[model samples]
Target: MAENAANLTATLQVKPSIFEIIAQKSLNDILQPAFRKLAEVLATNFPKRFAWLNNYCEESFVVINWLLQYNYLKNYDSTFSENFYGFKRMCVDGKSLSNHHIELSLLFIVLVPYFKRKFDKKVTLYMIEEADGYFKQASILGTNLRRKM
Candidate 1:
């Protein structure tokens, strides 16, 4: 009976199915309340940027979900889990700062965890250049503004 059971178990392929892949891909993280509130502020203050904010939120959610799935599948922790929490905080701080470049920095910082998370699972970030480009780091303020404003 033990031999039969082992054979049966072995014969049954336990690999993930297409449905499982779809389900995993559909997973979404619960957005933190603070993050939601910040999004609300962004929507109110910069309605034009609201679409960007929503896109960012969705991307972040997908990243967190993917990381959680990878961690479960591999039976291990990932840097994404460690970085997600910190990334949110950094983004908020960057957004609060008056510097435009820092605001961009904050945006990219928020995206880093997502990029790493997706990359680990062999998924693309879609906008590769936007995700890993030095253009984001360029200073927005001019020399004259540095002295006056």
Candidate 2:
């Protein structure tokens, strides 16, 4: 699966500040709230996305570092892969940050396990629904920003 998917790539041009802005805004306005709401609905005090933001910063790229500072995010890495994996590939491939693709991808890495643990496989639809909204917003914003440029 990985090998087959590796051949596909898309390129867009956006400034790092766009990534910083989205990361900060999404964490405060979207991701953190989502985590809190999920935990509330699930009736469990699972670790919040805010707590995991710092770990996401570690060994990360320049964009994530900017996000870390912008959001004032700090926390130990969650129990998962040792390094932020997909991000490195994204940077290496020269994709722009105007799109929330990287941010959403990382969020999935963090949230998927929580869903599996809390609601088991049933959380699949919920995750998809939630992500669709964020993805659409990102696509629109990216398109407008690129058009303006």
Candidate 3:
């Protein structure tokens, strides 16, 4: 009985994974409003480029929410850094991401794998099709020639 209790306590105290933490927080806090705002901003700022997001209907919300959580692992002299913006960590309280700051290529790169794993087949296909244009635009406009691919 004592062994059972100890094991139960340990199991209860198990820490959530980083992915869990981000997913829970993002779903609760930023999903709806961010989705609406992203649609409005994308339509207003880069209408021709990001216009497909508006046409995605309900799925656009999920796709935008996923894209906003862009992160990449970077290694610097053996130290690893995770560049993430999902928690609004870099923003003033209550502010969402601005359209001007959206990095299309990063969204394309990060969201492909994320959608594939998290969403159903139909949604994933739609998201990939939409993001392809962003990827190509990023390739042409982005200053870094190495990232052109």
Candidate 4:
């Protein structure tokens, strides 16, 4: 009986079915309440710092997202990663800041963690849904955010 069972098992090939994951998310969807609370915290605690940020009507977080979404962002990303993981400097163009650039920097510094958090959640969800999928996407984001940053 044991031998028969073993023979039957051998006769039947067994493997988990591979599933293709296709997820859709809109560009607008990701921006929900983005870095807004962080900006508020900065305003409340360190009121003097970036005081103009609150007054400035233009959504600075939008610019940071824009930078992350920038087609030329690779120009900055490689420098950031090289500086972070391997070596020498944050050799970023924004380092050569004009007064206006300082505002953009402030926006970036505050919003980066928020963006990282958002991405981390997606990465986990992606890993859960597909350990390594051929078509993992943040969908309509128009960029492979994980691949980029």
lDDT of each: 0.47, 0.43, 0.52, 0.48
Model 4, stretches more than 4 Å misplaced?
Answer: 1-32, 71-149
Give the clashing pairs for model 3: none
TM-score of 3: 0.26
The total of clashing pairs for model 2 equals 0
- Candidate 2: residue pairs that collide: none
Candidate 2 residue-wise lDDT, 18-121, digit = tens: 56555644443444445445445444334464444444322222344335422321221221121221122233456533235545545554445344545754
**Model 3 lDDT, full chain set:** 0.52
TM-score winner, 1 or 2: 1
2 or 3, which is superior by TM-score? Answer: 3
Q: Assess the local accuracy of residue 69 in candidate 1 as a C-alpha lDDT between 0 and 100.
A: 38
Stretches of model 1 off by over 4 angstroms after superposition: 2-12, 28-38, 41-149
- Greater-lDDT candidate between 1 and 4: 4
Q: Compared with the true structure, what per-residue lDDT tens digits does model 3 show for residues 1-149?
A: 79768868755654557885766545545445566677778877999987877667357665554444443211111101123322222334535444433354345434554466456868878989888977788789974546455
Model 4, residue 79: C-alpha shift (Å): 19
**lDDT score for residue 6 of model 4:** 88
TM-score of each: 0.24, 0.23, 0.26, 0.29
Among these predicted structures, which one has the highest TM-score? 4
Write the residue-wise lDDT of candidate 4 on 59-120 in tens digits.
57656655653322334332222223322223356453344544454346436655676689
User: What is the descending lDDT order?
Assistant: 3, 4, 1, 2
Off by over 4 Å in 3: 1-29, 63-149
